[model samples]
Target: MFLLDRPTLGATWGSTSADESRVDGFYLGTYTPDKRQIVLRDSSLVTIPDAWIEHAWSAQLTLLLKDTKRRAEGHYFNIPIPRQPGSESAYFIELADPDEPVMYYTVPAGWQAEFDALPATVTVAVKEKKQGSDSWEDAITIDTIKFSRAF
Candidate 1:
């Protein structure tokens, strides 16, 4: 029972508001099973029943930012991935790198609407913790990854 199967490619500008502040890359999905959860290579992992297994894939999004301001200060950026409907019952692993290919599930039991309602495109922004700053600030708008899958 495979659910999602497709290749992804995207690139966007960083929050630096500079020409050099940009991130771009592409990746493929690969299915791998495990005792605990389904792992997508070095990117992400999902915990679901073996029967719910439809298809699995992995890919990576390489990031490149010119504003070494935060990295130089020992800080890294965060790429947020919104939770899908019914995700509360499912375990989702977030990878540190934005380029890492993640695993998505297609369960006909109860996730049809969630999958159908999925956004056609998702925006991945870059945030950094500045020195002397208590919280993170938006640096730049990364790529708007357009998703295309057949439910």
Candidate 2:
């Protein structure tokens, strides 16, 4: 996540501060699904290192709402298929193919039948919280995200 911040400015947690210039502090992390663990690294991009310990998956949810309104219908199970170990290079090569379709996740043999029978859509509720606010605004209904075979 990118936060508008500078090294000299000081602000409390959940507090808001305004800065004139463009200075962003970002944290990068990777999740190990098989271990159900996330490993975060201190990035050299920013002088002041920041740590994020809350729901790491929230970023994906936030991105899913990026193109749509505050709320949209999403798949109940939108897990991405993980690539096999040592296949990273080949995966990137395949993704470079213009005609190749993108896939969300791979289904194991045991879940293939059940996965195919699953419903196509689900309602996704979204709300916004202003800086330093303890409460979240009421959920709002807006345009739903488009899901196609590529999803």
Candidate 3:
């Protein structure tokens, strides 16, 4: 699950989406525990000699909270998502989507504002398989941070 990173260690996990496919533009991520490349998917753009390990965690948890909150009209905290295989936290939401899913994982407002104020490195770990259908966890894609110019 994204290597089970800790908040205190400096990171958060969550996502949210208003539309049906809220997180479509987000780049899929993974960790590939074998070579530690932190692979990111660019439609199979990576042809280098590197292996990918399934990363089932995320850089933030704002996506989950937002979606569930909106669905319940801001009544999601009370709900509890079951634990999915290869996941670090066990919120009420299920780790359902990995292919162009619509979800926004955001950091706290203040902290996020500060973090966003400067250049940052974003790590994205997506589950290779959905827990709903796949009885076995097979997340073999982890896309690490890359540089993108707005110009």
Candidate 4:
């Protein structure tokens, strides 16, 4: 998941202070095998380059759940890709499905090298850890995305 950088798209959840830049909506994104490359959903397909990793690896988005109490709340979203899929990977040990409205994540710095080593194709396992649970339940397996980086 990635945050769309449009402030006018949603209601303000936090102060508009310059120190706290915020995003509006969350766009479903695909993490291809290409290192630091992410395909984001917007008016059309937008491929963010590795250079963006330096500045946009983390962001704040407003929660837009139907629940009035939680809606419009600010949440921090970060990139925390696993070294590999499966529970053995520390990145897979996260709390819940951040793709959910209650966004929660921690950015792991210095993952560029690991990302660059990823194969040209990979399967991602989608899992969710419900509240009060100690284990993750496999929800589904995302289909693989293959693209040619050959120029």
> Per-residue lDDT for 1-151 in model 4, tens only?
8756656444423222212222422221323334333322112222222111111222234376232212243322223343333333222322222433332233332122112222232222223233323344533222222322221
Error of 2 at 44 (Å): 22
> What lDDT tens digits, residue by residue, belong to model 3 across residues 9-81?
2232223321211343221222122222322232322222211111121333353433221111111110111
Poorest stretch of ten by lDDT in candidate 2: 13-22
- Candidate achieving higher TM-score, 2 or 4: 4
Candidate 1 positional error at 84, Å: 24
Residue 106 in candidate 4, Cα distance off native in Å: 5.1
Residue 62, candidate 4: Cα error in Å is 44
- Top candidate by lDDT: 4
- TM-score of every candidate relative to the true structure: 0.18, 0.19, 0.19, 0.21
In model 3, the runs with Cα more than 4 Å from the true position are 1-116, 130-132, 135-142, 149-151
Q: Give the range of the ten consecutive residues with the poorest summed lDDT in model 4.
A: 48-57
- Candidate 4 lDDT score at position 70: 22
lDDT of each residue in 25-144, candidate 1, tens digit only: 111121122333333322355443211111111233335422222211111121223333553422223222465334232232321111112232322222222322333232323212
The alpha-carbon root-mean-square deviation between model 4 and the true structure, to one decimal in Å, is 16.3
Name the better of 3 and 4 by TM-score. Answer: 4
Error of 1 at 12 (Å): 31
- Ranking the candidates on TM-score from highest down gives 4, 3, 2, 1
Worst 10 residues of 1 by lDDT: 70-79
Order the numbered candidates by lDDT, best leading.
4, 1, 3, 2
